[model samples]
Target: MKVIQVMFDTLKRNALNAYEASDIQTPNFDRLQQKTVQFNQFFAGSLPCMPARRDMQTGRYNFLHRGWGPMEPFDDSMPELLKQNGIYTHLVTDHKHYWRDGGATYHPRYSSYELIRGQEGDSWKAKVDKDMNIDGLDNIPDEFKQRKIGSIAQDLYNREHMPKEEDHMLYRTVEAGMEFLRENKDADNWFLQIECFDPHEPFFVPEKYLNMYGVSQEEFNGWLMYSHDDYTSEKADQLKNFYKALVTMCDAYLGKVLDFMDEHNMWEDTMLIVNTDHGLLLGEHDWWGKNIMPVYNEIANIPFFIWYPDLGIQNESRNQLAQNIDVPATILEFFDIEIPEFMKGKSLRKVVESPGEVNHEAILFGYFGSNMNVADQEYIYMRAPMPGKEDYLYEYTLSPMRMNRRFTPEELQGAELDNSFAFTKGVSTLKMQTSDFMGKNYQRFGNKLFNYKEDPAQKSPLTDAEKEFEMIEKLKRLMEENEAPETLYTYYGLDQIHSVEDVRKEHEVLDREQEAVTEEITFVNYHVKDGYLTLINALKDKTKAQAMKQHVQETKAAVTEDDIRNWIKDNVDKEEQARLFYQLDMTLRVD
Candidate 1:
C-alpha cells in the first residue's frame, strides 16, 4: 500500500470559485470530487506558511510552542514517524522559507526530499517573458510593462507574492515519484508528500490564462483589494483572475499525475490525499493577504479530499471541522498504528466509515502576533491584547522603540481620540504596557463575540452576554494553557530588564557620534538584476517615477546613504570604480 499527499500552499477558497466560473475547467479536481471523500469545512491549524506546515507535520498544536522558527528536537514530526515505520517519505516543494538555515530541518527528516528553487513569482515571470520573447520589445505599453515588471518586482521583495510555479514543481516531483515507483513499486509501501507553492500572491498567471478571464489588466485589479489597499481595485481584480488561473493550472498538473497513477496502476492500492497548507485571503474582510487580519473562513477554511479504493468511501462530502493535524493521525490509523496520545486531532476513519455523519463542536484559531479565537459551528469569540496608555501614547508620538521615554501631557492629549476603534479605546484604559508593568503577569484585553451562523463575515459584533462571557472565559483559559512561548516579547526588547543606566549607556555612544560624520557616500545594491528592470519600467510612468524617487530618498535617509556607500566601497575595495559603476547602472536603468 502507498500513500500520496498533494499539498498546495495558500490556495484560497474564493480562488477555487473563480476557476469554476472561468473558461478553464478543472476536470482533475472535479474527478477527485467525484471519486474521493471531500471535507467542506476543513480548517488550518496555524498560519503564516511555515507555522501551519509545522502543525501539519508534527500533529501537535503550534499554540503549544513558539510561532515560526526552528522546530524543536522534541517534535515528533509525521515524516519522521513514517520513516520509523518503514514507510519511505518523500517531500517535493519550492517554498524558499523551508530552505533557510533555521527552517530546513523539517525537510531533511523525510527519507528523500527535493527543494525546487527559482520557480517563485519573478522566476515564473522571467520564464513567461523569456517564453513570450518580451524582453527585447521596446513598444510595450507602460501599463503592460508595469504589470509584467511589477509582478517580478513584487515577487523579488515579498515571498507571499511570488508566482504559482507549483505546477512546475509538481511535474518535476511526479517525474521523480514515477521513477521511485518503478524501482520501489514491487518492494515496500511508501508515503510521498508533494507540496506545491502556488496560488499564493503577487498573482501572475500566463498571458494565455489572462486572456481566458475576459478582463483587461486594469479590470482585474478590483478583485485583489487587501486590508491595506496595497493594490488598487484594478490591480486586485487582475490578481484574482491570476489566482484563479493558477488554481486551474494546478488542477491541470494534478490531472497529469493522476493519469500517471492510472497508467502505472498505482491507484489500486494507494491512498491519495489532496489538500492545502492554508487558504489565501482574496478581498475578504477588505484584506488581500493572510497575516495582517484575523483568520476568516476564506483563509482558514480549506478543501480536504481523500481517495482510497479499499476504504469503500467514494464520492462523499463531509461537513466535518477537520484540522490539517488530522492527516497524520488518519495515516497512522490507516496502517493500523496507534495514534500518539499527545496528538490533538482525531482520525478521519470514523467519518470515512460513516460518510455523511460527523461530530464537530469547536475548533481553535490563532494569530502569532496578536490574538486567538475559538469558533464553534455557531459562534466565534476572539481575544486580543489591548494597548495600554504607554502603547497609546507611543502610537501618537510614533515612538515604537523608546517605551520607557515618557511623553508630556500635551503630547498625549490628542492621542486619546486617535485612530483606535471604539472597543479598543474602551479597553485601553484598563490595560498597561509590558514595560510599565513591573511583573511579567498580563491580563487578557478585549474579547469579541460574534454569531458566525448569522454573520459569517463577522461584520456585526455580538454583545457580551452571560453565555458570551462564559465562552470568553473558557477560551481565555484554553489560550493561557496553550500559549506559545514568549519568544516575541524577548526578541522585541519588551521582555528586557533595562535600567535607566542601561538606556543611557545604549544611546550615549550614538548621541556622541551624531555630528562626527560628514560627506558620506551611500550605495544600495539589489541582489536580483530584474529589480533594476522594474525600476526602469517604473520610470516610464511619471506618477510611479515620483513615488520611486521619494521611496529611494526615504530609504536613503533611513539608513545613512554615506554609511552604506562607505561600507560597499570598503567591502569591494574599489572605492571610485564601485561608486561610478553603481551610479551608472542606476542611471542607465532608470532612464
Candidate 2:
C-alpha cells in the first residue's frame, strides 16, 4: 500500500469551483472532487501555518499548551511512527517554515525529505536590492511601504534566478515528488508528502495562468502579504484576482499530478489525499488577512479531500465535522498502525468506511492565548478571555524554541518544571510565562457566537443564552478531554470543577483563596519599564524595530528617531540586521 498526500498552503475553500462560486477556476480540484470524498465541514484545529502543521503531524492540538514551537520530545509524529513500523516516508516541500526553529523538528521525522526555498523573504538569493524603490505605489501606508517594497524587490530578485516557470519553488517541489514516484513506483509500503507553499503569498505565477483568470499581465498585483491591512475595495478586488490567478496555477500543477496518476494507473493501489492547512481571508468579514481576526468560515473552515482507491470510496461528500488533526491518525490507521494514546484526533478512515459516521460532538480550535473557539455542526462559539485576565496564560513545552529563536531569558525567568499532563511522557517541561511578545493580541476581537444555519456570514453574534451555554459546556468538555491546563478554565471564568480532574483539584482551593484575597491584595500598576523600552529600541532589525515602534506609538508613548538610532548602534552590527529581521519576522508572525 502507498499514499500520496499533496498539501497546499493558504488555499481558500471557496476558491475551488467544486466548493463555491469563484472567479478562479480550479478544474483539477474539480477533477479530484470526482475521485475523492470531499469533507464540507472540515475545519482547522490549530491556526496559521506551523501550528496547523503540528496538529496534522501529531494528531493533537498544540494551541492549548503552546503558541508556536517545534515538535515536543513526547510528540507522536505519524511519519516517525510509520518509519518505525517499516514503512518508508518521504517529504518534499517548498514551505520554508520547516527550516525555522518551531518547524525544524517536523520534517526531520520523515525517513527522507527535500526542501525547495524562495517562497517569501527566504533570503534565497544573495543579490537582492533592499533599497529598490517603487514609485507611484499610491495609498500605501508609510509603515507598510518598506515591507511592500522589500517583498516586491525580493520577489524580483528571486524571479531573476528562476529563468523558467519550471524553476519556481512550487514547480520544483511537485517535480521532486513526481520524480520520487517515478523512481519508486514499484516500491510498496511507502508514504510521500508533496507539500507546496504556492497560492500562499506573493501570488507569483506565470502570465499564462493570469490570462486564464482574464487578468492582464500589467494588472498582475503581487499578493498582499500584510498580516493586517485596510484596503480599498478596488485594491481588494485586484488582490483577489491575483490570488485567483495563483489558484489557477495551483490547479495546473495539480492537473500534472492527475495526469501522472492516469498515465501510471496508480489509483488502483495508492491512496491520495489533497487538502490545505487552512484557508486565507481575502476581504472576508471586512478583514484582509488571517490570525489578526476571528477564524470565520473563510479561514477556519478548510478544504479537505481524501481518496482511498483500495476501499472504493470515491465521488462522495461527508458532512461529519473533521479537522487537520485527523490526517495523521488516518494515515496511521491506513497502515494498520495503532494510533498513539497521546493523539486526540480520530481516524478519518472510519468515516470513509462508514459514511456520515460522527467521530466528535464538537471540535475546539484557536490560536494559543487567543479565543478558545468551538463548533458543534450547528453553532460556532468563540469564547473570550475574561477581562483583565490575559496574564494567566503559560506556554507548556518541552521545546523552548519559538519560530526561529530560543525563548528569551526574560520569558523563561519564572519558568517552572511541570509534568502534570499524562502525554508529556512523565518528563517535566518548562512552563514558560507567556508575555506580550508571545501573543499580546489575545482578546482583541472579543467573543462571537455564529449560528451556521442562520448567519453563515457570521455578520451578527447570536444572543441565545441557552445555546451559548451549551456550546460553552461543549468547549469545557473537549478541553478537558484534550488535557487542557487548569489556568485555561480560570481564564474563561469557568468553574474548575469540570476541568482535568487532578489539575482542577490541585488548583481548586487556591482558586477560592485567590478570589477571596483579590480585593485585599494591592496590584502593582503596570507600566513599560525603561529596560524593556531599551530592549525594544535595541532591535537592530529594521522590521522588528519598526514593529516595536508601531506598537509603542499605538500605546501613545513618546519615542523618537534619535532614540532608535542610538539603540541600533549599541545592540548588533548592521550586517546582522537582515538575519535578525528574518528570524524576528517569522517569530512575530505567530504572535
Segments in model 1 whose C-alpha atoms lie over 4 Å from true places: 17-24, 121-170, 177-186, 214-226, 355-360, 389-446, 473-591
lDDT of 1 by residue, 48-95 (tens): 677777778767666433335545455667778878888788877766
lDDT of each: 0.56, 0.77
Per-model TM against the reference: 0.63, 0.82
The superposed Cα distance between candidate 2 and the true structure at residue 316, in angstroms, equals 1.1
Candidate that scores best on TM-score: 2
Model 2 earns a TM-score of 0.82
The sequence of per-residue lDDT tens digits that candidate 2 reaches over residues 253-312 is 899888998999999988899999888877666566776556788888889999887788
Instruction: Report model 1's TM-score to 2 decimal places.
Output: 0.63
Candidate 1: residue 386 Cα off by (Å): 2.7
